[model samples]
Target chain A: MKRRTVGRSDGRKVIVAAVLVSLLSFGPTVRRSDGQDTSAIDRGVRIGIIYRPGVRPGLVMLPRTGQGLDSVRVIVARDLDYGDRFEVITLPGGDSIRLASTTGPRRSSAGGSTATKGATAGALNYPLYQALGADFALDITAAGDTTVATLHDIAAASVRRSVRVQLPRSSDPDFRQAVHRLADQALQAAIGTPGIAATRILFVKDGKVYRIDQDGADQKLVSSTDRQAMSPAWGADGRRFAYMEFQAGKGWLYLQEMGSGKRTAVATTGSALDFTPAFSPDGQTMAFSRATEEGTDLYTINIKNNCCLRRLTVGRFSDNLSPTFSPDGQRIAFVSTRPGLPQIYVMAADGTDQQLFAPFDYGVTGASNAPEWSPDGQSVAFHRDVAGTLQVFVLDVRTRTVRQLTSVGRNEDPTWAPDSRHLAFVSDRSGYRQLWIIDLDTGRIRPLLQQSGARLPAWSPRLSEATSSTP
Target chain B: MKSVSLLLALGLGAAVFAAASCGGNPAPQNTTPAVDTAAENQRVRDSIAAAEAERARQAQAEAERIAAQRRADSLAALARAGEEVRSTLAAMIHFDLDKSNIRPEDAATLDQKVAILQANPELRIRIGGHCDERGSDEYNLALGNRRAQSGKQYLVSHGIDASRIETQSWGEEKPLVDGHDESAWSQNRRDEFEIISGGDNIRRP
Candidate 1:
């Protein structure tokens, strides 16, 4: 009779947790965000990083222990929230909930929260937390030059996973990025996909190229304020970038290193008006648009040796500009004006097999431009004019089926994050041009930058080179 | 009327001198006091006529000086020949949406430039194409290039040396007007000319 009563109470606890989660969650709402209706990519997305409706997992950060570890706790919590896979509970100050502190040596298995009782909520009063709607909690203990993070499942009342991440002293230059990488790994451990916290987005603000982290911190200007700079892009390694700068009545492309600030102007063509630089996946070649009296055409040069400048298109009198290379480096997608209005067209990297990539009616659609191939090679994101306003659109590479992703405001320049599930674009939704990020699966929209006058968002590739190894 | 009066006064003085001459030179017959008095009166009338003619001549000179000053003032309001030629060269030629071909009206504008270039062989100029903010940055760059190149082609075809003209495209980066509607856009989609060298004294077209 006693065993039956215990079982009944356990079932009631699970039911109460589910009900509370539903009441507090903000589900996916409607947004053109700008794309077309009736897309297969939105329906039967087998491999999409989709989130279940009305079923958000609750996450909490166990109050940090040890000095100089506050940033680790705060950043990880913000990152996981931005990841859009959790309901990140913000605990009030001064120990609103019971948290066990660990000042001693790190535990061999999982620290604190003994879980010796097996199959309960937390080590102390976890059943109470479960009743309060927490699904998981992260306990972080700072050790010498390393931080130990223990993941605890509240309802199961057991340890889930533990990871020891390297975090140099706060004075270290890369200390913040190291913390960002740790958050990415935590999301990878909590969910199946890694977070984009470690990635940096390059954008144009007040005619200068600026770089910002995913959490909206450390906004640094990468280009000179006096010089005219636009269309900044990076290769897969994220070590260097290519952008267009004006000099002596012509636009010149420059390759700049992120580490030592070394810059060199491209040597392919010195006479024509050149702009819109894109790097190949291997970082060996750069494809750009050059214009002359004959016409505007696509051109590629071997940046590794800075020789072998090759022409990609020859539509004389018709403009062919804005080249975006495919993830495999075999093909490039660009904007061409051959069919009345500008349209997106794809061609082989060797300037062969050129064809229209994005489909639109002759007189129906306005214009399609700024096509960017995703890092995963599954889709190409660009903006198209719908009626009179420009909206963001995505094309599935395999099916060639296009879907509109935004319609709320004038959204343009859809650049994909390294994770491929989020896009950083410029939108005037708040009455001014600003950078906003959208997660494809969760349908969550958040402003990436606070200031207006920001455009040409270029997301960096995954920044885990120096801090690799997933949790 | 004033000229008629001066002519009448001269005529009267001439008659008086003739009477004096006739009376004095034709006869040593009469040495009458009344005849001498008449000669004195004639001399006095001649002197008055001379002073009046001098005043009239001075008035005419003052009128001419005022007219010349007015003409000079009007000329100052007009730009110098070199400045006018520069304005015609600097006159921006506009293009249709996504088009670079020279229109008939814009061709007329270019013809003015060609004439200026031909008139001043030592002159060299650069044409910069621009676009509205409707298209993407990359697309606008190409469109701007085409507009500028087409203008250069027009000048070359009109017998202006290609070497004397340089072309560049500012794309939509630089705008003559800061607006978003058609008024701003129409003004933005244009080609501007700047003197590169040897424009110290441009000959008017």
Candidate 2:
């Protein structure tokens, strides 16, 4: 794989190198180098660059086994660039300077042939990478048994970052999420700000509800009732949540304070099956599925009043199930089985100007459900059960690109964390249903909650300033 | 000789009259003795007949009052039992959307019904499960049957002894209220209990 560089200037390469050495003389306190203002670098510095004319300065992402790269890498690379700290590069095979004799096939053969192969290989690659003008090499190795990712800083001549994440030996489902997190962390450590690693996901699984950390840790069950409980959405402040629970044979929407375990039902329209609840961006209103004998529809309820509900969709033939409000809260995207099969549809908040976002294809046997908008509102993630196997897929609104996120086992109900850099989903791959988080940048997968079968994860919005101010 | 015979007969008659006068008042001495004996015997017989007629009238009135109280108590008990049966049945059947299938948890409520049936052997009940206003009328009818059957089957399974229970389905046609929202739907989808026979004799507090 070819690695790219950021902030490379051919005219100042020599000057920057001299200045860097002098700056190092002052120790870590120097904090920045010349040509890159210390103030600007102190605030935030874009790493991964080597001085090379006519070459882009970014991290190059290479498919480890030459298989088709998962779209999660694209999302990761795009997110890093969007963070304004790194440039991303795509190094196709046969592009750029050839270093096969020094760092490629030779290194593999020499390691098997000699005891001194390690030192020899490391020695031979210093000048070769310098000639390529790459500040760091992001080596992503995903083979049959293991996936190892490392960020090597050629300028510092040290292993700046390395992470080895492994999936269960039995199933080799895509690990887009792990790779994304690894990349994001590498950038964070290389620069200064913390990435979206410590965040958690809240979603529903097997009709129960769960919340899991970003690294797929500390998965805890939030709700497990006899009747179906689903469509958990986080409040904008991230400390509270809203979901749908069928209690006393009535579909009711509930808002819960996460810490105190106190819950209040927002709507109780008796036998109707209310589901697919999504909180508005302001945390004041909730959009959810309200199904009666007449037909299912989408409705929004005010959080404070709880009793006042406004119907958002009305039609003769269409039955809407999943309702998700956009980041702006002006529009809602949901799944409607109106066209005889489940399809993605979008409508105004007040049930006006309904338009079909994605058409249903009869060829696909499984239905589409759980339409969740990305944090940025640029794309939507959902699950489609194809031939009894549920897989996660994302639909880019602008490009109309459908990217498959998972390949093995039955994986469904994809939800994005507050940062939109990772997706949490439910998978039955572990012999029991569990919650799993996928790093969109690196394709790494981690099980968030394993025991007692967790499912249906929804990510809470970032904490608000007022809430965080409280003790 | 004729004078001696008359004196003896007169002496005997006078002695008999003296004996009767000493025991009580002289038996109606002068007027026809045979007539007096017949009248005394007739008076004793009439007194006995009058006492028997008075006893018969008292017994008939007492029996009539007891019968009236029993009828009123039985009617009130039946009303109370009917109300309990209706409430218990309402709590028993829970139906899905456009689908009438009794869930297993409903069995707890059905178990209560077995005890009621056992205590009131004369009480025969009709179970009816109805659906909400969702699907076609015919479909809801079938769904309602499934719901009622679910409740009936549960009661029989818990040893209610099926013969006392009867099942019926009233589809979306008989909605408790007319509305499309969740509240109305919940009211419409229900299992109702109706007393068919023998409930009138149920005892109440």
Candidate 3:
């Protein structure tokens, strides 16, 4: 993997540290980031890249010897890059002897495996790294049934954090996530910020739902191959997701627990289409689109209570669908065809005060669909048809202005990452529909999954380390 | 119940190939028999009107002669109308891009469907709405739903029982033609009427 310089201008983006009051209701008590801009709290981190690039500490990955160690180095570097917090400096190679343990022998309790000596400093050339513009460096060493990771602060020349991670076998399906978990830990120790590298994404490909990593590795089937699944939505807890399965000539929404793969049909009407299920950030409610003989309307059900199915927008011969909840769960941003063509609309969470949210001319613009609200509650990402092709666009909620993100081949279905600075969307730039991620801060676009036919990607929240596996 | 079982069986077989549209074969278009229009009936009506004028001039045997001519015109209209019942039940009406409301041009076709359903009380139909490949898949589904509903609403508004018509949206999943141009899209954005039951003893409405 190659490392690029973080240009100064591209590094500035809106990031707000929203303190979500873990309340029982849905109306937003969120302390808006844009409202707090220019206030006294702007001294430190805002999301990932809002900090001054000058203060961005440089980092490197030291090479080591062990079976399957090379794959670890590659994945961890990609993870660090995706984290967007570290100024990752890629070295040609590190001394292999630096892998040997310098600390005295100790039992490894992490993997519950008996092993000698954990991670410690060997022959680290700190001065050479400092001259090469690196402030921190990560080193991984493996010996006697244990893989140990050590983070070093180049300036202080001291070990910051060290732990022995019992990595799953390279052939196991959980191997990639285990390594990502390490990268998340490294980020926390380096900057005291939660990293989204350990998170996974859900997308629909060829009529089935699939899960992929943030860096485009470990693409696996999340829904059954026998059942046709589309429009996957992730819960904030990261263990539950909802999707629509086409069965018996109708589409129905089903909620699935990833661990047991137990899918229970959610509250929806029979003989009607139910799709695009979006769980509120509070995880207490779910909003979806249901089409009846009358018209297509937006509805919400109390997911936690399994009752209180409330209709939000009355289609009245027009369509209101694709509901994405704001971070505070107080408002929902959805696509409404009430204007004769689909446009982004926002409404209160309790189904009131509906109005057009995104700016567009009635006759001058094309149809916009699939609007997703960022976790920070600042911007909404969506795709609109321009001329003949569809392109991704971002709408800053405060300014009410729109910016086109992609102008290449047709791009649609923009989904925001937990970090709020990255988005995963379906783009046909390569001639086939695939999932792509764009960094809003740097305007960097990369493919999240190489698998063709991927569509409707939904990024998950920062997953905890214990549940980092398929569940 | 029978209609539900019949469609479920057909959907299972098609679902596998339809979702995996890997360019093996072009999609099969809506093939249900349908009458394009009752042009033959229109011409017959004109002739009947002309005969009435002739009968008025010849008042000697006016009653008998006019009755005989009236019977002949009735038979001709019945034959034409019967052809519409069997073939035109699955007839499709086109829609504009992203518009679900029925177009003025498609009104006459839907009116004919209303007549068919009225004449046969037991008749049931399924209106499958479709769209072109231009829009997003999920959005297209909702649009297609409105398209199907629009056709149903038109029939229901015309006095047909709402229960007799079932609506489904194929979205952009099933296209009648394979192309990216307007020609293919115009054909793809349409509502197809399929008979679910009561077509055995066809009769003119």
**Could you give candidate 2's per-residue lDDT for residues A1-471 as a string of tens digits?**
112233445754545444333422323222222221011111122223334544333444432324233343444444454333344433333222223222334322212232122422223254434433455556554556565556667677666676566632222222333544555666665665545543456765556667654544445677745555755778877778877765543456778777656787775544455666788888878887665433567788787566678887774455676778888888888887666656678888778988877545676645666788998888889887676556888888777666777876678778887667677777766676666666565344556654545656776554332321211
Off by over 4 Å in 2: A1-194, A204-208, A220-228, A267-271, A304-308, A363-365, A462-471, B1-205
Better of 1 and 2 by TM-score: 1
Better of 1 and 3 by DockQ: 1
TM-score of chain B of each: 0.62, 0.55, 0.60
Provide the DockQ value for model 2.
0.02
How far in Å is the alpha carbon of A368 misplaced in model 3? 2.2
CA RMSD of each candidate after superposition: 11.6, 19.6, 24.9
Give DockQ per model, in order: 0.53, 0.02, 0.47
lDDT at B180, model 1: 81
Lowest lDDT 10-residue stretch of candidate 2 chain B: B134-143
TM-score of 3: 0.75
True contacts kept of each: 0.83, 0.00, 0.67
CA lDDT of each candidate? 0.76, 0.59, 0.76
lDDT of candidate 2 over B164-203, digit per residue (tens): 8766655564687877688888878878777777765553
Among all windows of ten consecutive residues in candidate 3 chain A, which has the lowest summed lDDT? A15-24
Q: Give the per-residue lDDT digits (tens) of candidate 1, residues A1-471.
A: 000011222444356444433433323223231212211122110101112324456677765444578777877777777776666654432132233443324332221233223222235346644654567777766557678777787877887777897886666667667778888777777766777888888888767888888878778888953788889998779888888887788788999887666789898655777889999999899999998877788999999999999999998857899999999999999998889888999989999998988888889987899999998999999999887778899999888889988878788999998778889888888788888888886566778867978999899988875522211
Specify the highest-DockQ model's number: 1
